[model samples]
Structure formats: C-alpha cells, structure tokens
Target: MNPNGPLLHFVIAAGLLDSFNPCAIAVLLIFIALMFTLSKNRSAILSMGFVYIMFIFLTYLAIGLGLLKIITIFSIPHLIVKIGAWIVIIVGLWGLKDTLFPGKRNILAIPIGSRQLIASWATKATIPAAAVTGILVGLTEFPCSGAVYIATLTLLSSSTTFLKGLIYLIVYNFMFVLPLIVLLLIAANRMILEKMINLDEMNSDRIRVISALIMIGIGIVILKWFV
Candidate 1:
C-alpha cells in the first residue's frame, strides 16, 4: 500500500485528462453565462462559482471514496487492477477512435440520457441552485468523463491504504477542479463566453488526440505494472 511513481503519475495524469473533457467545460461555461445574466456583481458571481466548484469537488471526492471501498471489497486487489488495466486500454482505444474519426462520438463521453438533465441543472445561478447543479452535474458527467477516474481508483485500490487513497483522491479532484477555477476567474474578469466556447471548438480535435495519447500511455503503464 505504498505510493509509487507510476501510481502517482497515473492519478495525476488521469485527473488532468479528465478535466479537459468538453462536457464539463460546456456546463461550466453555461453556468458562467447564467451567472453573468443573474448579476453584474463580480463578488457575488465569484462567490457562487466557488460554491459550485466546491460542490463539484466534494461530489467527486465522495464518489472516489465510495468506489475505492466497493472496488476493494468485491475482489482481490490484483485481479481488480488487471481488470482495470484492460478497461483503461479499451477506453484509450475508444478515445483514439474518436480522435481519428472526428465525427463519431466517443463512448466515454457523457451519456445522451443525462445530457438534457445536466444542461437543465447547469442553468441555475443562485448559490443553492448552483451548488445543487454542481453535485448533479458531477454525478451525471461521470459516464462521459469517468474512464481516468475509474482507472485511478483501480490503481489505488491495489496499492494504497484507505487514508492514502483519500489523500490521493483529494489531490486528483483538486487537479480536476483547477481548470474550472481558472475558467471561472477568466469569465469573472468579463472575458466573453463565446470566445471560450469557440476556443474549445477549435482545439477539441487536438485535445482528443492528446487525451487519447495520454490515456494510452497510462493504460500501458497500468497494464505493465499490474499484469
């Protein structure tokens, strides 16, 4: 249960790749736009955004902890790690497919079933409303953005104690939320949302390609280390 270089690398890499997912970015953008319309008060906007991000951080952490427990409880750690490596490889290849074929959606993306719900929840701008939206969005977006998280949890389940896993989960989620915080700050400064949206659109393919490569690298590392 000692932390090692590969384990830490996988955790951090998974978080960073997962954070760049288009679905999460889109929801944050919508929330920011709604916040702008709700009030010109920069302080209030930043405060509500913080609340939203806080909820997101909490929700994701809770899920990671819960998953760690479940994964540890149900199977032998080594077996689970091997299974997880295969899953990561499959998901990595799926990402590669999306990058190569551009129009076809990646299976790892947010599920169609949850997209409408996520969009609906993201429209709320009040602190309570945004907090609830954050929780819901975090849960709902899992299917679309959970590959890295699952892989990291699988890695952790095999190699770390509960407390260490908790600490690593905190680190991973912090990295996950870092980009959203940066985007929120940018939007708070009166930068246009359209520009951000356009930028995402422009770089999305390249992002996918980069994400695919990283996932593949992590998958290979896990496969080699575990299998």
Candidate 2:
C-alpha cells in the first residue's frame, strides 16, 4: 500500500467538510437514532456500526478500483483528474451560490428515494442489522464529494497501482466515518442528537457554502501542480 503520505490531511478535511453537508449530517443523526433502536448493547451497536461502515468502505473500494482500472487502461489518468477538478469546482460554486443567494431551489434531487435504494442494497447484502448503517454510510457519497474522490483516484491511476487506489479509498472512508463514530459514542442521547440535528439543519446551508469553497480550493490545488 502506497503511503500516499499525509493525503490524510486532505481526506480528513474532506470528511469534516462532508459532515457539514446537509445530507451527510442528517444521515448521521438518523444513524444515531438507529443506533439507539438497533440494540441496547452499546458495544454491539458500535461493533455493528463499524462493521457497517467497513462494508461501505469495501463497496467504495470496489468502485475506486474500477475507476482506476478504467483510467489506467485509457492512459488518461491526469486528464481524468483535471476533469474531476472542474466538476468539483463547479459543484462547490453551485452549492455556495445556492446557499448565499437563496436561489429558487431549482435543484430537485430525491434524497428519500435514493435512501430507499441504499436500504435495498443493504438488505440484499443479507445483513439486516447493518441495513440502516448502510443507508447512512451510503448517503455520504454525495455528488460533490464523490466526484472529487473519483476524479482524484482516476487521475492517480496512471501512477498508482490498483491496490494503492483501494488503500487511498479506505483511508478516505476511515477519516470520513470517524466523526460520526466518535460523536455517536459520546452523544447518542436523543436530546444531544436532536440538538445536533437542529443546529446542523440551521447552519446546513452555510456549511454547504463553506464546503463549496473548500472544493474549489482543492480543485485549484490539483490544477496548480498539473499546470
């Protein structure tokens, strides 16, 4: 596994930025609720939750590997990354604009429907206890963050092996999941969760804006070295 040294910082920032995302933060709240409902054994719930997240990590690993293979085959890894940078930058700007300008909500995404698909995928995995966890974990791979991750991995494919791609993906997911795991253990109580969810919702738009700016910055970072 390539050390991809200190990409950890970028991935952690990405994860925290992801937490600020409305869907991500809300799903974490939902997971906290599920954690309470799923088991009275805190250890079991936490164990299952980690396993649940591992399952997500593995699934995305497959995706990252596939993307790397495709890019390596095409001999356009850097180009793929550059394209991804543009996409990340644009998505970030759009989210920022949406929050700052209060645009007429032209976006009509179906979050619940997507959640149902995630639920179905989880159930099909045959681990019923992990179903909700799958849904929650899956939601974090939204358009913006997912695009950035995908693009970066694809671009690296030319230089990184398939194993490295998988490793980087694993790192990204670990960092991404850490916050919720820590928070759930410390503040799984309904009052705390509700307060977090409410506060998250109130500031979600601003979070989106900030996340967008970050994405834009990351995009520029990638493009800078290339140019």
Candidate 3:
C-alpha cells in the first residue's frame, strides 16, 4: 500500500475539521468584533487580521516541527504514533461529552486567565498586539483542537522523513487556518460578518459532533493501519 495516499487524505480531512474548531472561531469572532470597534478602516482591519493569522500559522508549524524533531531524536515514532492514536480517540469522546452534556468540566478549554490576556491583546488593535494574540491563541487553543495535529505529527514521524513531514505540516497548518482567512476577508462587511457569526453559533454543536466523529474515525484508522 502507498502510505502517502491515505496520509494525504487524512491530512486534508483532519485539517479541515480542525479548522472549524469552536475555540479558534470564537476567539476570531471576538477579535474581529474588537477590531471593528477599534478601527473604521477596512484596510487596517484586514492588515491586522492578516498579521494575526500569519502568526497563528507560523506558531502551529513551529510546534509541529519541534515535536517531530523530538520524536525523531527519540527514535520512538511507532510507539508515539500508537499512543497518539489513542489520545485522539479519547479526545473525540471527550468532545462528544462536552457537546452532549453542555456543562461538564472541560479541561480542554483555554484557561480563563489566558483568555483574559488574549482579550487585552485583542483590544490593542496593533500589528504587534495582533501577532502576540495570535501566538497566544495558537498555544492556548491547542488543548481545545490539537488532537488531529498530534495524530498527524505522530503518523508523519513514523512513516516519513522530516522533510516530507515538514511539507505535510505546512500544508496541514495552511488548511487549518483557511477558515479564519475566509472570515477575515469578509469581516469588513458588518452584515455578512454578523451572519457568519450567527451561523457559527447556531451550528456550533453540530460542528462539534461532526468533528468528534471524524476524529474518532481517523484515530481508529490510524490504529488499524498506520500503527
């Protein structure tokens, strides 16, 4: 079997699912709203949004590279891949619980203190502040949405060279941020932005359910084939 084929499919599917993560989308909406209040110029808002998203891409890519390096150095990619697959399954179940129960303690959420800090940075509406906020979001949002990422990295580490894995990581992270890029593009129009926000809110639970299922499915596949 050609491993790259299934891996590529998984990368694209998992990346798209991760892109709609409620945590990242919620933070993005908040940031866009704050940006609207801070600046009336559409160009300024877009510029800041671009910077914010660029930082998010960079941060996530860096983390993937770093983890891949560590896994390579340790020469335990197969073990780690198996462990990551189980973790992905667990995270999917946890997500489903959070969706169904709707109030149980969620250890996967961004910390309140970190959220407050991110809010403060969002309020600044400066490029540097946007960069910092993006970095913070990238770090803090992982627990909420990083199971797929870990699964991808583990699989990559086990089956591909670092260079090939790096290429996949770049593509995966790009797909991961594609939704945010779309949101940023439409953010200049208040009515459209509000509609998108409304849709996101209305379908948030459905999205979670779908994402959970995908994660569980991917984990099972990894355990069955890649492990």
Q: Backbone clashes in each candidate structure, one number apiece?
A: 2, 0, 0
Residues 188-219, candidate 2: write the lDDT tens digits.
56577678778777877666676677777778
Off by over 4 Å in 1: 1-6, 102-105, 111-113
lDDT (10s digit) by residue, model 1, range 60-84: 9999999999998865887888777
- Every candidate's lDDT: 0.78, 0.60, 0.84
Number of the top candidate by TM-score? 3
Off by over 4 Å in 2: 1-20, 34-48, 102-110, 116-129, 132-140
Clashing pairs in 2: none
Q: Residue 55, candidate 3: how far off, in angstroms?
A: 0.3
- Cα shift from native, residue 165, model 1 (Å): 1.2
Question: Which residues of candidate 3, in runs, are more than 4 Å off?
Answer: 1-4
